[model samples]
Target: MTTTSVRARFLGDGRIDFERATLGPVANGQVRVRVDVCALCGSDKRLLRSGSPVVPGHEIAGTVVDVGADVTVPVGTRGIVYIPVFCGTCRRCAAGRTNQCLHLRELIGWQRDGGFAEHVDVPARCLLPVPDDVPLDTAVLGLDTVGTAAHALRLWQRTQPDGVDRALVIGAGPLGLGVVAVAGAFGVGEVDAFDPHEGRLATAVDLGARAAGDLAAENQYDLVVEVSGAAAARETAQRVVAPGGAVIALGESDEPYTMPATPRWRRTDCYTVRSFYFPTSEVEANWDLLRDHGAALRDRLTVPVTLAELPDAFARFVAGDYFKPCIVSEDAP
Candidate 1:
């Protein structure tokens, strides 16, 4: 039998065009997913607009269309693809830390094709079951944004046992919105979010946060988080960390940007920069956490779009539209 699949490809310099591709027989520990709904992360926006031959979507949810010989996923199983692929024999993989494996750069969109397509081929270990109650959009995001936030939250809580007395999130991107929503769900006190964009600042307030102009001015908070590390945000966070407080750095970019460090106060704890990756043994940890807050996150993920609308959606991505725009297929649930 022969099969054809449709997917999107970026032809370097900011052009994303529709294309057709084929899938050969599935390999060991691999499965094919028919994408239902995929959320475009900030990185996808950057990469797509950078003009590269890359598949754009990383946060993807779909049904299992086929399974490789050694794969256990049954056809029709609904799930999201965990994009961090690793070679099992490597030292990092052997220790069950696939995300940090040296070969991670070679997997998913970079070396192998990714989920901007109708069908995605992934390792069985990378497919996570989508909860029946959670919608496809939420499922995809749970795998990344929410997962990272929960991981950071756990570490943040460990640093200050009294529970969140005050919190600061610095960014207006989707991840920042997600951090705001999670902070509310987890009962953070004095939720102060800083973003220059009036629209996103208002959205933060709507999501149960108190919008503020400068985090450093509101520096009384015990916990500070850097989500995007913009020049302004970095400058603000240096002043925002409370004396002896813990700061979680969650942003993705590391340009040659020099950040202004705020004068240190003696009663202070230096910031902690966390760039977390997926944990393997904690199998489906993200799904479990999402189960706890899926409904509300589903509400946060209410921004909707269509497959044919991808070009427009991506254009808006360049223009910064919506708090978090989610691309959906006709039958997405």
Candidate 2:
């Protein structure tokens, strides 16, 4: 049977155009998802600006429309596709960390065409079952963002220094807010989040953090969580981190940021840990961290938009104003 699919394709040199394509039946080892909702991640816009011609959206959640022979998934079953594909025989996959595998591009939305399309194919091993009640739009958070946050939290707990009661999260974007919420859930006595944008600061507070005054210089906390991708925020994190404290730099800013010249503060007696790929990778690690906080947070943080509004929302994101804008599939499965 033949079917039509809609897609938001990046045609290179900072261009994203929606187009129609035809899809054929899945073959052995492949599963097809009737796309539901997709999220515009920070990485997508960054790549566009950097001149990479690639499918943009990575956070994807949807329903299974077709399963190749020998595949275990049932038709019409909703799920989130784990983006990291692996050849189990590889040393990295053999170690059970698929994301680190060398042959990991077969997954949707990264090496191949991603979820921006109405239908996406994936190797069977990368599929993960989404909870029946979880909204497709929100379920994508589990596939990556939440899982990444959870991973960062676990890493921090393992590397934390003594006498750290507070955590300073330096970015107020969705991932920054995610770090804040997870930090709070991790039992940190206080969580102070920072963002230059007032609108995102409000969103951060809603996600369970006390908003810091927009990157203004302050010497305030013991633990610094830098999820802000700003180049300047790195200095802010280094300045605010207390003596013998830990600075967890989780932000993904494009610009190069230098630590404050003061080696006494940034290096001496302090721990600097670069954290990434949290709750987004290890389910067992992220599940317990977010068992109580799921799609509810996404609902509070996301602004639902249809495909038609994508450019406008992306424009807002470019101007540093969007807060987890998720696309609603016109014909969501």
lDDT of 2 by residue, 48-111 (tens): 6653344557777778888888898888877777766677677767776666676755545666
Q: Each candidate: what lDDT? A: 0.71, 0.71
Badly placed stretches (over 4 Å) of model 2 are: 12-14, 50-52, 102-107, 161-163, 213-219, 257-261, 265-267, 278-281, 284-291
Best by TM-score: 1
Q: What is the lDDT of candidate 2?
A: 0.71
Q: Could you give candidate 1's per-residue lDDT for residues 1-333 as a string of tens digits?
A: 234778887776667788787768878778888878777777776667575555767778898878888776788889877777767678888887766776766656656777777778888878878767776777776766677677677667676766776788888566777778677445577778888777777777877788765443635667778888666666567677776677777777656445454345443555565757465654466666667666666675457787667777778876867555666777654
Q: What TM-score against the true fold does each predicted structure earn? A: 0.88, 0.87
